[model samples]
Target: MKAVALYGTIGSLVLTALAAVPAGGLTRPDTAGAGTPAPAPPRIAFGRCAPVERLPSSVECGRLTVPLDYAHPRDRQITLTVSRARATGGPKVRQGALVFNPGGPGASSMHFPMYGKTERWRKTARAYDFVGYAPRGVGRSAPLSCQDPAAYAKIPSASPREPSAAFKRQKYAEAKAYAEGCARKAGPALRHFTSANNARDLDMLRAALGEKKLTYMGASYGTYFGAVYATLFPGHVRRMVFDSVVNPDPRQIWYRNNLDQNVAFERRWRDWARWVAKHHKVYRLGTTPQQVLRAYDTVRARLGHRPLAGKVGSAQLQAAFLKTGYNDAYWPVRAAALSAYVKGNPKPLLRQTLPQPGGEAADENSNAVYTAVECNDGPWPRDLRVWDRDNTRVARVAPFETWDNAWLNLPCAFWPRHAPRGASQDPARFATDVTDAALPQAGAAHRPVDVRTAPGALPPVLLLAAERDGATPYPGAVELRRRLAGSSLVTERGAGTHGVSFGTNTCANQYVERYLLTGRTPARDAYCAARAEPKPVLPAK
Candidate 1:
């Protein structure tokens, strides 16, 4: 249920709602069917949400009216919000527009233009207009919301078996209430927010920009978006860079995916505990890993019955624990905080704020759009018994996170709507008859842009799995590369993190940058070595 990016506020509602399925359950519609070829790119028609005079000269913002359904281009229209920062160098050097997406099925790309200002990006800044936008049902675009923050905050956390059946019943009731609340508040739009629609919108954006092709960069969930776009609009693509790619296998749902994360974190937690034990002088939890782990579990168990001063409860603890897997930089801080809480001072832990609430309106908007899209993309088992069996199996191996993840996604058990049709089981077949003129040349160089069609397209995409990644597992990356036809494997070595870009190794950064800027992929699916922190020098006395 943890949102994936800075736009976490909007995404939290949808992710939490959909996280109930097993891994790969949210497969999007295959792009293989007959549909009219996409229309030619549209000319730019700039319009302002606010007066243009008040806008900053460096930013160009506007809205474009697109079809609510591409199949009926002349029908109902919705306005999509967009923003751009023009290239800093002279016009002669401009390379065209480069669009960016920071992963979140729901994240806003509206601020992506600013990334060009960074030292790494500035090198390429002179050549392209950096573009950003809010996806449908997200920020400043007909936004969604739920009315109650307290109601959402009160959702119970996962816990161990309790003495009474009454307690378990209360927990179940709480989950049901949250699901019902969302259904009552979110209406029709809740059924329309699929990834396919978003992809269609991206193509529409390409048209409005007057570009013959799209050049893009996407991360995490954004990678999935980029992949689908390539499948649907292969000809319109000039170049694409996807980092920390999500596997496209259809069986793994968001909830099932968390089970993989839980197992990964359990290993990481033990590793952290061992380190804490070795440095007992700094953190006096214990002098051995087992002792320190016991101490940590003791704190979790104690909070289950009585929350720490009514603020830091088991749910909050689990949320915080899950967040630790996102980055190694957070490990020591989290350990210190946990040690402090176990020793009876809970203020630091309690003070950690939850993601900013989108308020009732935004929550309903997000929830509605999320369900509309996710449920429509694939079919989830409607039988509670199936979930019961799957979750029980998962719980046997990953006791810490399975049930909590299950309850987080309980809304799907009673999802108010269903997808238009069930997803196809077979991989979609590409039409060989589609003409070359229909496809744009891969770049100025005439290289075929369809990576999937190349011998290397199925080659191992450099998988940067973090040792302690909680949302997506390091092993998942390994498995993904293994499933890929010619993939070679690489580890972050010892890095414990989520998205590998901006947060970890310089070596990893260099590898990714080289691939993006020069298309020089790692020679054999290499792993960037882990970066170790430098030891502090004590004054020589």
Candidate 2:
């Protein structure tokens, strides 16, 4: 669930008082003084946004202040940048605010609503104002910086497939250094970058928008965020759609979840290999899955020795192709790149993997925020040995992502060790603390939501995921289905794309469009047989 950005595509409510308690009665009204009404929502004066925010001119932008710590609401504040595109339909036809997050607990989502202008999304745009906001610690919303952009870009790139002991140690040191950098630069704010706070900030955004209830659409990690929102503000939810959902089981809150992603990614990697093999006439990488994999390993090994144009090393090559596991829309370009490279032309491969000068440095913010949020959200293994052992074991079977992902997350092992309440004081103990009750909160610590809400307490949510999605994986949707009793699951069978709704999967998009346009959902789980894999158009000979 970590990335620079995700593209391609890729719930109900309300009842009389006779209905069951909202959010299974788990919600707590914003803490208020006796006989005092909760505070009024902050007024967000909409106006021109800075050009750097990258929003369309027609979309207005504004900022709202929310407490850095809801527990001490008045003590510290942070700015949240929000944007809106008015519903295309008249007010009479408009539903309400439809806020969305484009995954990446760290990715900038200010431009997300712009997708509404596209034909496939025009209908949803007509029905609701397209609302978007940079979640806390992301983009223009009080952005978190842990290292100089230039320094981050220059950090030594290590091959994900390296299995040598020296490589593991090197990665451990780098992760520790990264964690230290965040703590040094971010200070107390680092500990406060929890997902629970993100959910709380979202509720405030809802109030500022003057919406009586929340209508939301989220993909990848956004689904997890939405789940936390529903758990904390069940009464405020009007409707929701969770795409490529993360599994919410306490045991897999995140650390184990990433390991799970490794196996799934390997599966998708094979899927891509098979596709390339099928199109051997075009790519000519191979004629069988095994042959294609050999071609791929050969390219990686060659890059390992002499990086293409001294930029795309084995590390960069793996990173570029990893996108294929997230969405096969990347398969053709990436497949072609490898094929061209194998045929002694490195230009296409380099084009696909090299970062523009000063571009990768900007990714520092995303990387910083991603680590801060994930580490703070729940407990991580305090011991590096635990990680090394687990990742090594998984690497044998799922080599594509195991070590790479291990390095991405190793920072959590050295995160600031002040565990939330109920954790042990020892830093190592805090890291290994697996308190089921304190799993998956948006803030410091909280219990796993009793997602089984009473009738009418929560609307029937819609969940979308490809059967073979590597990022969030398919089982997550099924597990989420079990947790959210009234929810429906739409599976795109045989597909490996992470974001499944708005891409070429017409059958899947039909469900998405229908549920968003009208609050209708299948009574039970649904399935959409996979469409044929995309055919690559060969370039002129």
Candidate 3:
């Protein structure tokens, strides 16, 4: 449920297991053979990082190797590329290393360390070295890929809103073929790229980095990864921040999330449409939100028949405007493009503005990893029949992304993964009690962060959200704060951005800066007003 800078959520989300899990389950035993001398505590071999063009000189890059499967420590190994932008004032300003994840179970976040050099993050930046990595099967970390790259496009689109039976059938075939590609091509990676494994990999890196506990910040899907890490290794967390939180219910981890996003994005798009309507003189396309929506529909319909110079089509337009639901910052530029297209001007429409998933050179790798992680992260109904029913039911009320998102995750229904042994039963006296650290698993695939079963109290962590962010709705953050006892939630009353921490909202970022440097949690949940909305354009010459 993620697009770069945009996103995905769940519906009918309930507050499941909010009780703090009792700490101190026996530390998971090492997997080395009984006779094997504990494999030398894994260490990172640091060196000059590759791909210097996009990276800052101050950041050092290195690789860390971890078991392909944690249970078989001596088996196949995978290397993760890690980068660090070190703190400037040695012991004086140095607090500790801060890890950052930019989300996308597939996004390459190793460069997040560069945020330390930016003026917006610089103050808090001086206190600690910023570290980031491309998780397993992502970027320089043994990236995952599908067998047929073109099958990527075979996945359905949002055109026509309601899907026909043939459309659903084609989606099923493509999704299955795509999943088979991952199974055939990804090998060991297909089995181990789950967030649970990501959490485990982070622990090894923590030990290698010599940090007693992890201080971290994650957005979008990263929030889910962080929650899983917190649940699995609560004792190792020092301070953390979750920005634009992800839905945490194990049952709703992703399938439910795709469905929920349709409703949320429609609401977000409605807000954008009204904003455009409020300044109707500038756009000249609408006097009411409905008119603005019709204007957008006109653009989509025109593109469907004849693309803007054969580049921007209905698919590209929908993909780009998805950002409107993310942040209002994109409103004007995108609105201008729409207006220009309406006036028989195709150049602006053709210009590369938003990163359309289909516009780029075929990228089966990133798409494959995304599906692999999401599908394997939890159970997706394998029954292809369920796809038509749920999506058809959802499209009736929320037609926006119902089909596109359904196809985006459709590959999961056909993902080639068998449940591990004891998938339903606890592995090692694992939670005979539902309130134990094992938490409760719908099965081996449902890996929700189990707070009730997680051991020990978490250090005071901070969570941030926009009251109306469509990408990851605010309720997820509220639920997280309630479930995780020591967390504080900072709200931007109507900021409307997906990841709200380091952007223009000084109020929200301040809490992040304060917490990272001083371990300060707000007295309670707090709120800050949204920045002034951008005014419409002046009369065109």
Off by over 4 Å in 1: 1-3, 6-57, 155-184, 253-256, 353-373, 417-468, 474-491, 533-541
Q: Write the per-residue lDDT of candidate 1 for residues 222-275, one digit (tens) a residue.
A: 665565565545556666655555554433434345446556656666666676
Q: What is the TM-score of each candidate against the true structure?
A: 0.76, 0.90, 0.86
lDDT of 2 by residue, 1-541 (tens): 4833456220111111112224313222233331222244566788987898767788999998887765566656889999888899988889988998878778666876788899988888999998888888877788898888887877225584666888777877778788779888987667667666677677788888888788998888888878877766778888899988888765575787888999999999999998898999998888999999988887787778777777778888888888888877788888887777777777887777887675654488888888887877665677566676777788999987788888888877777655453333233444343333433232223333333455555788999988888888788888888877689999988888778788778888899889988889986689998867777855322
Error of 3 at 536 (Å): 3.3
* Candidate 2 Cα deviation (angstroms), residue 429: 7.7
Q: Which stretches of candidate 2 lie above 4 Å from their native place?
A: 1-5, 8-38, 419-452, 539-541
lDDT of 3 at 378: 65
**Predicted structure with the largest lDDT when compared to the true one:** 2
User: Which segments of model 3 are wrong by more than 4 Å?
Assistant: 3-41, 147-158, 353-363, 420-456, 537-541
